[model samples]
Target: MTDWLSASAMLLAGVIVGAMFLYGMRRRQDRSDLERADLEAKRDALIARLREAPDPSLERDAAEVLRKLDKMGVEAAPLGGAAGGLKPAATQIKGFLWGAGSVAAIAAIVFFVTRQTKPAAPADPLADLERSVQQNPDNLPLRDDLAKAYLDRNNIEGVSEQTQYVLQRNPSDARALTYSAIVHIIARQPEAAAAMLQRATQSDPNLVDAWVGVAWLNAQAGDMPRAEAAMAEAKRRHPEMAERLDQLMAHLRGPSKAEAVHVTLNYGGQARGMIFIIARAAGVTSGPPAAVKRLPLSTFPIDVDLSAADSMMGQPLPQKMRIEARIDSDGDPLTHDPKDPGAVAEGVVLGNSVSLTLK
Candidate 1:
């Protein structure tokens, strides 16, 4: 009876031990599942954050989270075969991303260094002139030089500013007045130019160029008597120009003709230096001109009669001719370089003031 009691108690104790072992195993499994789910949720959250990350700071944080996930994956190696296999792949992906980040950092450094080593562009000549002018505003010679430079470049606004400044300092300045007259001529205001030229001569009577310009304008206006008087004055002021004055006189007294070609010159745009006007028979590209006149660019919008006296030879003038006006950059009447800007009027008739544009 005592042996039977012992066996029954041993069986009861075995049953209780077996039941406790099963419950502990189930509890451990539930904890493992909870840990895996938590790790997966953390990885998903890190991936989402990485997708919206704007800068390197968030990228680093995401990388760190990936490393932790990778470590957790290794720690949960016994959970399943799939979990164990994910460890190496996750480590490789992390290494690739780190390499890419390092490369990007290196590229940024190279780009910045290259930019720092590049050379700057050269300074502009006009800018240098402007700076010098600003530094010495009262220098009249410098101002005039700057004004001339502006005129050469056809910069009307710049020319006006510099010339106006010089004029303000000395209103009776002959040179400034002449330059202003030139500007007026370029602007196609002949009356204003003539006034300025007149003022320039009045301020200084001995100004030979001014006197010559006056004579030329008068001749253009068909006031031959006034032109001759102005020419005499120019010769008196500078006797060395007597021969030139004689040649101009001869041109003014052109050979008599039943009908002479009349030309009215008009400037379509900006013009400077000298102008060479020629009348050639239509289709005659070479040989001496039928009539020719060389005048300063300032004498534009002027009417001139072309007759046999303007002819290079003593022969009669052609009936049918084309008139050409060339802006001579070098002031050489003998040259008609194709590069020089010019204009031509075809089918021109004698005894008629045919208007033409010097482009």
Candidate 2:
């Protein structure tokens, strides 16, 4: 008879090696599955982000996610096949001695590990707001909150997009219309801004922003009385907006002096291109002007006011100024066509008027 001891040794060794190999494969598969699950979760998050607020980099990130998905496709293959060149009795004894114990230990370990729960992470306020907005696109209040959050973060485009969607669904939405008006203001579309603000006020008379916006628009158009009236009515109706309205009142009133610079331009030639009225701090030879005004050269001998309203630096109006008047032949300030007519008057006092001639 063949040595039973030798056969038993080989059988035990084979069982141990096979058990180790199988365990390693299972561990790898588990890790791969976990990775795939994590990737899928991340993919879903990315898709949500893209839907809410997308940028150029998101496409690259999405492509990378797809590439990773192409991998981790290992099938759960069942370990199979009968023992060959080994005595059945020896194999049975080996399995009984080691395989059952090993399996039990692994199972116990796995069970304990899986039972331990990970602590939940803290919620992100912005992300939570975004998710809420995404889930309920019709909810205008939530969208407004989200838009305010975006504005806090200086995300103007995001705010605009949110406002646009809300307005598209409900054109009469007061808050959305106000936000759209603000967007138009940023885009330098004063007419559109005025229209939107008017709609907002008509839609909801209680909206403080609509009234405040009307005030601001009127103030910008040199209609101080109307601006003050609108602001006063808003403050009377919504006392809670007093602090903000007060600040706006200060801005609209401008400097305490409200000094004015009256200019008379004399050009004999027919108007062409444009004219620029620039005022700089007196005695400052080379630098940016404190205030500037540009107007079409449709008519010669133009009369215009240059004041703190047209200030470029927000610089307090100096006691004295070096005022300049330039008529560009090309209508472009960046270029000098040599034929441009210009005049400079040094040491011009505030509230003093000067008549300039193009020679």
Which candidate wins on TM-score? 2
The weakest ten consecutive residues by lDDT in model 1 span: 72-81
Residue 151, candidate 2: alpha-carbon lDDT: 58
Name the 10 consecutive residues with the lowest summed lDDT in model 2: 76-85
User: What lDDT score goes with residue 256 in model 2?
Assistant: 46
All candidates' lDDT scores?
0.67, 0.71
TM-scores for every candidate against the unseen true structure: 0.35, 0.42
RMSD of 2: 27.2
Q: Which digits, one per residue and each the tens of the lDDT, describe model 2 over residues 180-258?
A: 7765654335699899988898999988878877776676577989889988989999998899787767756664434
Give the C-alpha miss distance for residue 167 in model 1, angstroms.
1.6
